[model samples]
Target: MSVNPFPEMDSVSTAEPEPSPFDPIPRGEPVPDWEEARIVWKSTWNIHVYGFATIFLLFTIFSTYRFLKLYSFKAARMSNGYQLKLGLYIAICLFSLLRSLVLFTDAYNSWNIFPPILAKVLWSLAYPCLIGAFTVLLAVLLATTNACHRGKSLASSYKHGIGMGCCLLGYTALVVTADWAVMYSQRSIFLLVLCQVIFIAWGTIVMIGYASIACKITRDLSRTPLNVDRGLLRSFARLLCVCSVIGGICILMKFYAAVSTFSSRSESEDSPQPWRWLAFETTQRAIECSMCLLLILITGRADRKREILVVPKIMCNGITIISGLESGTVLKDIRLKDKQIIH
Candidate 1:
């Protein structure tokens, strides 16, 4: 029967406070349904990405196996060119294996089979290996061409080794720093853009290096004598050109991906179909596998040529001499009788 004079106070006391727009999600709680949907969609696309990585892994493993088998007994005697190639193959195997694992973890993370953080950790580990592999591959290509022309290993130079090591370390540090900034800092977009810029610069430098090497090889091939194997030099030059083209394409794709990601972030958009990104990654992996296959084939041919030109020992005047029959040449006889008597 009595009217309440403090109705506004009672209503205010009973009403719940609205959440702030800047509120952080509580830990150990599910994200919004939309966020979960985006995560699932992205992770699902990782299945195709990892599938391509698996194929690349198989190719790297086969390459490493073939290289090892081809040089099984010659490891100790391998030139710097071969050693660099061996290192490149090993690094690629590690990179591909880690990359596949990372992608698989991402795919599984969507289903809660693996933690999301695990995929990030795997990626962090894999990226450095990728840089290392790329460094070694570049070194091998340069060294191979130089060795072919000089008839000696350029990679054996201490200065060259030091320069390569410094470059690898510097790039690894840059990548790690960029990844750390992306994962931990609030200014992720700026850091991501910086990383992409760095990548573009690196790609440009690599393309230039390949171009110069290709040009030098072409010049040498034109002026080299008929006895030199022109085909091998041409093949290496072609490979360098191919690599440059592939690297340029990858850089452009990466730039596009970075632009899209930044635009999506700015728009507060989620659940952009993952297929576009995954398709780009799949194409990259396929190209890498094909390049590795080509490298293995080319190296195999070089090894066969070396085997064919290997001289057989012949006994002459109770002393050993190397026959150059396969090479269509003769060598001066070394009189070892006096040296043997002195020994």
Candidate 2:
């Protein structure tokens, strides 16, 4: 964030006029080919946003790995339901790592080097992977909410979120496939806006699902103890809500920009460059992934003395054992090198 993500022009324009969906532009005017322009713009934005993002994401990767190792070593000591939720969170982080790697690599790859057909197919597969990763995140929250209100009719809400997320994931594949086809055939801005529409709709649905889950989590948190897990849940809910709200704003801005490109103009320079803000894509993902990784670490941490987490064997070999964090059960086994086994 060397540069301000948002402009310092007072407040964001809420009442600003939006680009009209059915606006009539002259037939002779051609929309600027953003596909070609984006390569350069992306590089520029990457220099600012991705520089910070890459550093943060790398640190998150290291921290997440350390947390996972610590957690797994003592996982058996955790309650079954707590253990299961932790595992789900771990799975989500691992998948996010994979997605980040793929996205980082693909960002710099030139689609022009390969045959157009093959390139198009690979490109089409890319966004769906991103969408699937998001679905996994939503699934984590969905599971959390269900856990908080177990045996209640919360299943319906979780199921609906899952269903909606899965459908959106499927829809990305269609958008990519159709987008490639239209780009090759018609080269129309209409097709471009249509793709944005689908992307926005998909994002909106996912955000709505998250917001709903956050509301459920809020009610549950009020009655829950102020434990480390509860704290992490609070952090998770806050991060999700902030991200969803900001993401919604960005999507609206993008939509306005998408429509701007279709406006009638004598020159490309005169048209609004809606896609300029698209540079934040990588940065946004990095922030999200980093936030989740933080929550995972916080959840796994042994923040209290006498916290009983590790196995009995781990209590051996001169190792000091404390029991109280999770279960009241104390470690019964003890051993020290060059000395009799102490019990």
Candidate 3:
């Protein structure tokens, strides 16, 4: 047997070489399970915020669109008396649009697809818009009551509006500032709790005052019964009250979370209790969910008409019998025609 001197000739055909590690990581396919899971979570929160914001957006959009069309046609035909309410409606429409846009942008970008700097900057920008819209809303509310009086003068109404707006702005600023402290400084959990408590207390006061003034106006208007649609007005008032109460509760929850957080904080660690974080997060989400539901309900077509006053059915020993009024506005779908109301 001849020994093969050229054993090298044993392997002949060529095959493709393996890729190098230096090669770029190929872009991932559609989405992996982990990625998909993340997306689901993200979408859940997006829906939480968007669900409510979208409701407001669509309601305002259709309302504004129809109003503009009707207003144009009426003006052309020279009929249908217009009032300052038109301007107020327009402002509210714009405000709703702004809020929706801000929230939408924030949510969409929260996916981390954006650069960190951009994300932070956008987040900062979005929150201020929310605050601004709230401020503007309070202004509009006060202005609408310009015809009302607390005592001797109407000037007080305007001042009251301005004051309300300022107070909200101030409260918002403080809250945001404290939030910054949490993000920026080594402030103890106790400080954070204190900040939250102060912020919420002031905010609740402002909200209470706001509701009182609003109810007063509604009462005064009802005496003469202005031609303005009471159904819509009452719905809005109910929304404000419900939202304010929820907001107050959310703030209180934050305080509770903060207190728990500090209680668990060690002098050495900058971090607070893990459970506190969890509680805070849960409460925050709950608040968001509540807001979303309310927004959707606002746009829904239902005439709940929660009456605010109730009378006693019977009396008890040493106690006055009392009953409560249902207080909510049922949303109704209405069609509008050129300078005319349609079924």
As a whole number from 0 to 100, the lDDT of residue 311 in candidate 1 is: 18
Q: Please provide TM-scores, in order, for all candidate models, with all chains considered together.
A: 0.66, 0.49, 0.43
Candidate 1: TM-score?
A: 0.66
Model 3 lDDT, residue 138, Cα: 42
Q: State, as a TM-score between 0 and 1, how close model 3 is to the true structure.
A: 0.43
Q: What are the per-residue Cα lDDT tens digits for candidate 1 across 232-268?
A: 5677678778866766776676677667666765676
Q: Which structure is stronger by TM-score: 2 or 3?
A: 2
The lowest-lDDT stretch of 10 consecutive residues in candidate 1 is 325-334
- Judging by lDDT, tell me the better candidate of 1 and 2: 1
State the lDDT of candidate 3 residue by residue for 1-343, as single tens digits. 9997777666442445676644323111112233444454555554655775676577468647644653564322221112222333444455456545655665434455654334434433333333333334344343333323333333244443455456445655654454444444444334445555655565565467456644653454443222335565566567767866775675577566555545544433444333443345446655645643443343222212333222111221222221222222311121122125423
Q: Which candidate has the highest TM-score of all?
A: 1
Ranking by TM-score: 1, 2, 3
Model 2: residues >4 Å from true position, as ranges? 1-46, 49-126, 147-169, 187-194, 225-233, 264-343
What stretches of model 1 exceed 4 Å from their correct place?
A: 1-50, 75-78, 112-114, 124-127, 147-160, 188-190, 274-278, 294-343
Q: Tell me the TM-score of model 2.
A: 0.49
lDDT (Cα, 0-100) at 105 in candidate 3: 63
Q: How displaced is residue 138 in candidate 3, in Å?
A: 2.9
